[model samples]
Target: MNEKEIQTEIESRVQKKLSDLFTTYKTDTDSLQAILKWKPVVLMIGNYSSGKSTFINELLGQDLQRTGQAPTDDSFTIITSDGSGEGLIPGSTLVSDEKLPFTYFKDFGEQFISHFRLKKVDVPFLENMAIIDSPGMLDTVTEKDRGYDYMRVLGEFAKLADLVVLMFDPHKAGTIKETYTAIRDTLPESSGEDRIVFVMSRIDECDSVSDLVRSFGTLCWNLSQMTGRKDIPRIFLTFSEAMAANPESYSEWKEERNQLKQKIQSAPEFRINHILQDIDRQVNEIKLIAEAMNAVARKGRAKLGNTAKFGFAVSLFVFFFLGVILKGMTGFPEQTFLAALLGGTVQMHHFFVPACGVAGTLLVTSLLFTKWTFPRLRQKARNSLGNLITLETDYRKNLWSKVENRVNELLKNMRISEIWFEHQTNLGKIVKFLNKDLQEFYERIRKIK
Candidate 1:
């Protein structure tokens, strides 16, 4: 099947299998909607004069975005093709259109929307995908300077991007404060490491090969410190063909530039994997929650069984012996029922009154357990929800953290009797979807051209 057909099937299957669970757990579906509605997106972010726009322009083979030594643009521009002709779409319109996946940007307010735009071009490269070029990161800028939370906005875009290109130039060597913050704190939480492609752009600007080596070393060191990894990630060394001063000297690096461009062009292919992983992650979260609730249900059943057994035993003893105890204490009864039975003169008719007493006692006990004892058990369970499931792995722990509050809320508000059957069914559905349906989808995607 084609990309659109696969996407449609994914959406249909997710809605069928997990929509109710998402609503119950309060999992946000906006990112899923964004992925479904939009073409594959490549988000570019980097320090000022890091050659992000220059690199994009080179990829498109057009001088679309302004290029300069300093920061030339301070807007978030989405470049795509419209097929009708080249044109521009205002950010206000972009955020308001229901057909587009950008309605969530309305939360960023009008100030950010004013700085956001969509640039339509009649380029073949944009026909299958879209590219988002962000305002360059700066050391001196604060949230107040931008009149918006830039890191938050960037993170949101990162969550939706199929591939993220983090461009760095030799001049900065990956030391810009905002870039450091983004690499350290933002992208890790928003985008997966596999989705990010690190690039050392504008390497031709170095005076010599030794200078380039030194810059590359500095970048590697800074990235190690920022990403907290002992081993270095792959950093593509690239320089724009049109901007190279010593063209022959950097001729060997042209292939690197072309490879980076090819990587960006492969975003559409990556989008399917991203969608599948996203669905898998979300379903796994729900599965963990189901397992937690199942644990709670099991504990509830055990407690109820023990309590009922104890109550029944006490009631049975009272049925046979309560009349004799009352006669001994009050000194007003005739021969007690147990005494008469022991004398071998008791009749079936003589047992009817005590039977009535036992029935009353059992009914009262059940009411007390329902109205008082069960509620206290539920409260205790709710308070110690962390003990419900054993998080054996870091991945399970991560999933638990996402749904911990939801589980807490469920225990607080939902009855234990109501939790067991439904959540068990939900768990089965999630497991089946993940193991069978999702695996089949992956196989189908692998067959795609």
Candidate 2:
């Protein structure tokens, strides 16, 4: 067979395997259908205030996403093809219900509140692509939660992307290494290395044009080498603020941005189409695993049932034998005649005594062993199976966690936001005080390429 034919065969086999696995779980066929009908989802991820929301707005040629100086605590804004985007807010249902032009986070005080809104302009982008604005990685929240959010979004993004665009800011003195590592780590293993793209934003903030170009070039090279995609296109640079605030100052940047847009527009529409194939593969795998688990459970239940049946049969035999013995043991005239006719010295009174003893012993044994011992054993087996399930869940969670940590470590070095200290007591001061070594560590990353 030819190379293309071989690839098709392999994909078909994999898909069949996944479908077989998933079938045991009783998952709906339609659930897999949604995944198959994947759209190109672009996730804008970076540190808080790294111009992610702003850049998204600029890309759609409108202020669809909320942009401000305040730190956005909530991370996810899902813009889909339906002329709407949903923001998953933390506390209030109202925030979740309100429709805004784009999703954004605004400061509420010591507690960072999350809000979701909808916008119209992002709808067109969503027709072919789902634009996701993620929460900033370096917010003051717990690293675990941030990591979780990042990994979740990354997984979703991976499923949707024909290409991934990694956005960065260069004016800040920090490393791009961490960001690059995050992008690399979060990418799905199923995706070949050629699908990711890098973009450096806020180029207008750089000291000089040469510095911007040099930094961007170095970042592109380092990222390419690290990710083992040396042949991928160079990182694209843009002055997003200039594009937003004063379009005239950076016409070149604007042009570059447009070219990137063209690239996206012109790229092959295979990713979404390929997702249908992947869904088939995953379904089969899920079905297979579920079937195996079900088989084990059924076997265990059947074994216990058989043991119970055997005990019941033994009890009935003892009861009948005891009645026969009792009749022979009785010294009554009628009983003696019956015993004589049977040609046996059946002791009417004694017969029952020994038979009952045997019956009682058997009953005790069966009750003790089957009712108590066997039940405990069966319970242990069930528990073992349950533990296995738990372990499997934990294993998947750990794998996802590792991926998230790698991504977060990369984001920390990107210097996506600044800590303003107008008042004597700002949270940034506290962060700086605690993370001295970590900050230095990230600073070193800035010089890598």
Candidate 3:
């Protein structure tokens, strides 16, 4: 299949899965919708003056993004093709635009709004894919300075991106705290390593071949510390195409630059894997929640059983004591009391009235147990829910803990006994989709050229 065909199929599968998820989970599917609203994104992140904008301009063959020696651009720009006449759209308007996928970005407040933009240039390359140019990372800045969570915003983009370009230059060499924190803490642990492509941009800055080698080694050491990976990932060495005139030390890495460009062009092919991996992770999270709900349901039913046993026993005792009171006061149904005594003489005809009285008393006791005693016990259990979650494995316990609030919410709206059955049924449906339907779609994409 071609890139367009692959993208169409992925969207179709994700839509089907999301429909099932919405029906089963009974929550907002806004997050899922956001991912599909935009085309495949290749997010570019790096320290200041890493020539990220330069590389982007060279690829597009147009200077749409601002570039300089020092942080020339502070805004996070979403560059794409504009069918409605090429222009720059402000963030305030962009968030409100339904056609765009950045509505959720409004939560970052006016500070971020002031710093975000959409650069819609009429480029042929953008017709196939989109590029996100992040604000240049600096060692001195904090989340407070931006009046919003910068790394968090970037992380959201990272989650949405099919490929992430983490670029560096000889000057910084992977020493920035912002870069380290992003690698270590922001992106999803399992898939981030595979999705991210490291780039040593501005390779011409190196004084000699030996100098570039030193910079490469430094980046490797820093990456090992940040990612905790024993083996180094492939880092693309590239410089701006404009630097083609007598690059003293950069002459050796020209082939590497061409290879990097080729890799970037092939980014659309990687989208198939990213889409599948994202779906897998989301389904697994739901599975954990289902298992936890099942656990809570089981615990609740057992407690109800115990309560019924104890409550009914006490009710029976009360009925017996009341019968004795009535017999002493008015000698009502006197035959039952004497017959119940082992030494009393038997009178079958006289036993009829007492038998009728015992039946009525037991009926009243059963009603009280069902209405008041059972409900009260369930209420108490609801308040102390921690005692009810019986899980065997540490992984299950951890997953349950993360989704504990969701379980509590479900229980609050309905009986725990009902939840277990519903969750079990939903889990069966989800597992089948993941194992069979989702697998078929993924295999088709993998088989694509």
Candidate 4:
């Protein structure tokens, strides 16, 4: 199917099946839909002077971004085509545009917005895609230094992009603190494993093939440590041909550059599948949350049931002997209600006082449970949230890790009991969407030529 047709089909399926699920579970569909509506995005991230912009310029066949050995650009510049001419849009304006998927960036504050922009070019290569060029990652740089969290901003962009190219140079070999943090923490949360391509750019600068091999080995070891994945992802070794005077000398790896460029161009092809996977992952996250809530609800019900049982026993005792206890304590109304009952001297007028006493006892018991007992139980459940869900499998554990904070936030700020009962039903809907409707969508996408 064509791009528009595929996009429409995905949208139709989500609206018909998963839209309500997203809203009920508090997932943001606006950002998801906004990402769907825009052109496919290719996010470029790497160390300072890692040839990210240089490679982008090569792909666009023009000098669109400044090139330098040091960190050249500090702004997040989005380069795309309008087919008219060159133009620029500021970050403040870009975030306000509902048509784009960048509204979340406004939360990063004015300092970050001042460093964000969009550049429109007339290049044919960008007619169907947009390239986001980020400020290079640096070592030992704190969030206070940037006035915003760099890895966080990267993660947000990574979440929206169809393809993320993490470029590196032979000089650094992925040892930078920020780079380590991104691989270790951010990408796993934002982008899927398949969406990121590891590229070791500027390989030609190595003194020898052996030197290059050592750098590659170092990078592999570091990646293993950072990602904790035994299998190392494919890393493209490339260099800018424009900067290579001895092009013939580096002919062996020149085709790798072309292949990387081709991969970037093919980002649009990745768009549909990426969207499907993103939606699936998000829906599953909501499902995981619902499961935890169901656990909390179960705990809560058990606690309340125990309390009710105890309270019922107390109420029965009060109903039978309250008058006797009162008479014993104050020596008033000499005959107990039980004494009247056994002696067969009870009248309808005599029953009123004891009946009222039993009713008042029950009311006080209910009030104590509601006001004092249940809140403490809820707080205890919140404290031991890890015990709520059975994360026996690795996948369940990982999913729990992702939504744990969100669940904690909800439990802390909201009355979870009020909303907890619907979770079981929500779980059913989410499961049906994932196992049935979403699988059908996957099949339909696969059938597309």
Most accurate candidate by lDDT: 1
Mind giving the per-residue lDDT tens digits that candidate 3 earns over 303-416? 557655765675555434544666678887665444465556655655554455556656665565456654665565557666655666544454455456765665556543
After TM-score superposition, the amount by which residue 32's alpha carbon in candidate 4 deviates from its true location, in angstroms, is 1.2
Model 2 lDDT tens row, 1-449:
33234334444643454333233233334323443344455556655566778876766766667766555646466655555554333433423333421112222222223333223343464666666676655532454543344444344444445566666677432434544455554443344454565677777766666877787767666666666556756666766645355545566677777776765553335443334334433433333333334333444445556655766676666544544555567733344333443777655563544456556766776566545654564446444433323325433343334333322332232111211111112223323322452233223333331
Evaluate residue 405 in candidate 2 and report its C-alpha lDDT on the 0 to 100 scale.
Answer: 34
Model 1 TM-score is 0.83
Q: What lDDT tens digits, residue by residue, belong to model 1 across residues 1-449?
A: 59778978898989988899887666777777777788889999888789999888878888899988887889999999968779999999999999888999999998899999999998977887999999888765344588887877887787678888888788876444465455333232223467888899888899999999999998888877766568888999999878887789999988998889889998988888778877877777788888877777766667677777977887888877888777788963476678778899888765865787788778887777677777787778778877888988655776677689988887777674663477778778888988999889888988885
> For each candidate, what TM-score against the reference?
0.83, 0.47, 0.79, 0.87
**TM-score order of candidates, top first:** 4, 1, 3, 2
Please report the TM-score between candidate 2 and the true structure.
0.47
lDDT of 4 by residue, 207-302 (tens): 788998999999988877766679998899998878865666679998899999999999988888778777776787888888877777676677
Candidate 1 wrongly placed segments (more than 4 Å)? 67-72, 139-147, 170-192, 214-233, 328-337, 344-387, 391-397
Better of 2 and 3 by TM-score: 3
Candidate 4: residue pairs that collide: none
lDDT of 2: 0.48
